[model samples]
Target: MKLQTQVPLNKATNQIDYSSQLVVLGSCFANNIGDKLAYYKFRALQNPFGILFHPLAIENLISRAIQQKQYTEEEVFFLNERWQCYDAHSDLSSVRKEELLGSLNSGLLETKLWIAKASHVFITLGTAWTYQLKESGKEVANCHKVPQMVFKKQLLSIDRIVQGLKDMLHLIQAVNTKVKIVLTVSPVRHLKDGFVENQQSKAHLISAVHQIIKTGNATYFPSYELMMDELRDYRFYGNDLVHPNDLAVNYIWEKFKTVWISETSYKTMDEVAAIQKGLDHRPFSQESEKHKEFLKTLGNKITNLQKEYPFMKF
Candidate 1:
């Protein structure tokens, strides 16, 4: 007897293959999928501006990237000995002001180019709760550890979320009309926002995503539903009980593979998996003849795979 109900997933019409260019953006869950794609050696550019948790932050970055807008000194501020931009995650913050601006501009350029050639763009929204700068009245992507008193926290309305998503779609489509956009709500719980508030945030995101997909402008993947339904237990979460643990991520990834990955790519994925396993193998005796032979074989495998896809690096 089946113990749990599965989340119904339809096989995608435009499945991802080795030739497809992919752009993965948004929440840390996007990184989980992106990591899988990277392991299987797919052409994917993930979170060029780092992990953006909400739709408006994503929309802001995409808009600026499409316009090729450069970050200037005026947009960055010194905080805790590092220069930070309100528009990007702390991952892009730098010790030097000039370096931060350079990295921001470089990320924008990279994102612009990647979106232009992407065959599929995956966006995962994490929350509807955002913090607006008290002085500027601008919603900041990350607070960069700025004092809580300096920012006003608020929940975005469903209508505002929907409009932001639409704006993102318009901007992306303007640059790459044929690119398939896939949207998903992250399974990670924003418990810091309080349990009830977290639920409301996710509800807003889910509602807005469905509204967008109904117009046939994008596809929706029920990642959050899968976690909440099929894997309905605290064991699926990490030690913090906030993020999905590795087991949960792998489970969702297998589900994602069946629906979105092209069958033709399976053989190559297996080959890559073998190579990856070999690379991760730790020999007891490095000087042993057997280990030398194993290393040689691994090198040959890498060389052969690189011959087919020059972009892959060990």
Candidate 2:
């Protein structure tokens, strides 16, 4: 008898192989999946401007990138000895103003280039809650630890989220018509918003995503459902009990692989995994003949894989 309920998933029509170029965006969970893809040496560009959580923030970045908008000094502010842009994550903040502007503008260009040729774009929506800067009357991707009183916190309405997502789809499709957009709600709980409030935030995201996917312009992956149902236990959570632990991430990734990754790539993936494990192996004796032989074998594996996929680097 089945003890746990599983979220049923169907294989995607356009599966991802090594040849596919991917762009992964939105939320820290996006990084979890993106990191997995990267570890396996797939061609993936992830969160160029950094981890953005809400739909409106994501839309703002995509809109600017597609338009080739440049960030100016007036757009960035100095705070706590670091320059910051409300439109991007704190990870992009820099000690120098010019450095911050340069990074932001370059990120826009990189995003445009990747999105234009990406075979698959995975967008993971983290929350519907957003903070609007009172001075500019605009939503900010990250607050960068600015005084809480300066911003107004708001929960984006389902209608507003739907419109933002639609705008994103329109913007991306304008550049690359054949790109397949896959949307998923991040399973990481935003408990800092309060438990009930977090549920409300997730609800709004889920509703808006479903509304958009019904049009067949995109597809939804049940990542949130998988975490909540299939791996519904505290053991699957990190110490904070908010984010999925490595095991949970791996479990979700396996499910994702089954549905989204091409079966033909499996043998190659296994070979890559073996090489990765070999690379990570630490020999007890550094100068031993056995260790030397192991290193030689590892080097040959890397060379062979690189010959096949020149883009792959150890």
Go through the candidates in order and give the clash count of each: 0, 0
Q: On residues 1-314, what C-alpha lDDT tens digit does candidate 1 reach at each position?
A: 99999888889999999999999999999999999999999999999889999999999999999999888899999988889999999999899999999999999999999999999999999999999988989999998888999999999999999999999999999999999999999999999999999999999999999999999999998899999999999998899988999999999999999999999999999999999999899999999999999999999999998999898889
User: After superposition, which runs of candidate 1 have C-alpha atoms over 4 Å from their true positions?
Assistant: none
Model 2 lDDT per residue over 87-128, tens place: 999999899998999999999999999999999999999999
RMSD of each: 0.8, 0.8
* Residue-level lDDT for 17 in candidate 2: 100
**lDDT of candidate model 2 versus the reference:** 0.95
TM-scores for every predicted model: 0.99, 0.98
State the lDDT at 42 in candidate 2: 96
Local accuracy by lDDT, each model: 0.95, 0.95
User: Which ranges in model 2 have alpha carbons more than 4 Å from their true place?
Assistant: none
Score residue 226 of candidate 2 by CA lDDT. 97
